[model samples]
Target: MAELQEFIDDRPDAREVRKALAVKLVYQGYKYEEIQTILDVSLGSITSWKQAYEEDGISGLRLNHKGKKSYLTAQQREEVLSWLQTKECWELGELEYKLAFEYDVTYESKRSYYDLFDAAGISWKKTTSLNPKADEDAVAAKKKEIETLLARHRQEIEEGKLRVLLLDECHLMWGDLSGYVWGKTDQEIAVRVVNIRDKQTYYGAVDYLEGSLLLKAYNAGNSENTIDYLRYLLDQSPQSKITSFFGDGASYHRSHLVQNFLGEVNQDLSQEEWKIHCVRFAPNCPSQNPIEDIWLQAKTWVRRFCALIPSFSHLKWMFEWFIRHTTFDFATLQMYGAFSEIKY
Candidate 1:
């Protein structure tokens, strides 16, 4: 110990050698906390040094062994972290390519590349689906239109004379329902599953004002099913309230048949009688509909126990159960800030 201290004091620049000397002291029965005072090093550093010596003797304590130099400095890596958070999605290889071209730092191996990502606290994740083709100008126009309609219906909404309905569709499959679950590291989560390719489609609507629900299952969603759904809603609704249908730009909603039905219904009704109207949401914008959030909640609720669900019939039952059970709090849904007012 005396000789090691003398050597360290005589050669203060030999950091790696000093680290090895500290580990040797630990091997000679010195506690890490005790060694921290003598070596003028943190207990954490002392512990790591001891672990390295245990794993690979003195070689593990060697510095300048993080392999090839990183292209990015510490500060630059923090900048990269900030930049990554701002992106909607990215691939690791693409990011690596960008780093190479932008910072002139190329990694020699996949391990080193991943090490940098780990240090930056970035993880590979499933990308969220968003419509890249949505027109920004059209979205702005739709937003303004929605605002105008809300203002126009403000008095009706306050008086509860107008019913605001949001409509959408969803699909349920027989396999893994929605999200990831805990499992063995390398082994996939397995289940005794059947009908992996089969799916059931459903058309659903919610009256945000009255919290009423309408759900129907179908083989697929198309113009015919949409028309049938509208007929069902019109038949089920009260004969005195003005019902407004809000939906996305699915062809069925705007088809000549639907438009003709709506026009006929409006023509037959007096100004004070039951009536229907339609408003198309912006192109490629599902967020404009509050019912989309309800679908997500219903799926998440039922799919959490998907592995235990016995059959397709049972799954369908569970799906309907969650949909029926889900609380339709208009204020909470409106708070999502998709639309400033629910009048339209």
Candidate 2:
């Protein structure tokens, strides 16, 4: 029933829509004879359509003129596949146009075009951006440093005397809630955004040993908020004697105000015995911090239910709720050689 509704809303060809509507009516307890009378189709056609849909799903309802036989010869198919591989990207209509104009052959079903794409080793994928300024050597050195640091404190961490936290900040905006979703191709899909620039700052830390998460929201990620967030981390782990934070080299993280706060907290202890410690990842290499992935997952969680989020406040609440409630066991967390370098 849901498939039928999606197909109907997508506004495919009139014939396919008619078949899907007929099937939907049948599922809604309409008799085959009633469906025939309403849709002006024969009883046999309605029964066959219903049977085909049950057996093959949406693909069953697809129209094929050659009765399940290939429309293009094997040689022609090879030519099409070769032509498709010549481009990095394509649209469905381009393939259709190519077949129609060059070979005078056209398949009524879009699946045929997709099948051709599959045969040519093409699949739909999202592109990711690369940081041009990231230094490979610096990232490797930082990873090694973090591994050694974690190894030095492995005994304390195992005994629950020390807590390791990977920290990062997320600047979420109303525009961030907008992402890819399946919808009607003929109609424009839009999220109602009162102000795209309206933003919220979030500080998140994921426990390296326990997989627990700590999240806090603030007006901005300045020195003041950074200090408070550090205090919040300390407050959460009162039983632990030491808390170590690994994060990016944001200016506020190393600001004098934040440094002064840390100094006050560990004034009586030596550097090794300080209650709180902070380490910076290599510059411009966010991939080194697993907390970056946590932030991304939180935003993705909120975006999945963006339709139900009534306002920016609600969006922020939903984002925080997911982070605080979920236990993160990301594979990237193990990429820093913690498991091999540090004995549990």
Worst 10 residues of 2 by lDDT: 62-71
Which whole-number lDDT from 0 to 100 does residue 268 have in model 1?
Answer: 68
Looking at model 2, residue 69 earns an lDDT score of 33
Task: For residues 1-344, write the lDDT of model 1, one tens digit per residue.
Answer: 56445545665456766676777788689886677667665444555556655676444555644422336887778777777777655666555655655765644334665666676677777667788888888878876776676557656754566656677878877663645567788697765457776689998888765565688998888778877887777776664354554566678778888777777777866754547666778878777777887877777876678667778788889989878776577554553223322333
The numbered model that scores best in lDDT is 2
Q: Model 2 over residues 1-344: C-alpha lDDT tens digits?
A: 88889988886688888878888999999987688678766454565567778888887776652222327888999999999989898976677667765776655345677789999999988877668899999999988888888788778877777888888888999988998788897688778889989999888888887777888889998889888899999999898765555566689888899889988999999977888888778887788888888888888888998777789889888888888789888898777555422445
* Cand. 1 TM to true fold: 0.65
User: Which regions of candidate 2 fall more than 4 Å away from where they truly are?
Assistant: 1-117, 180-186, 337-344
Assess candidate 2 and give its lDDT.
Answer: 0.79
Residue pairs clashing in model 1 are: none
Candidate 2, residue 194: Cα displacement in angstroms equals 1.2
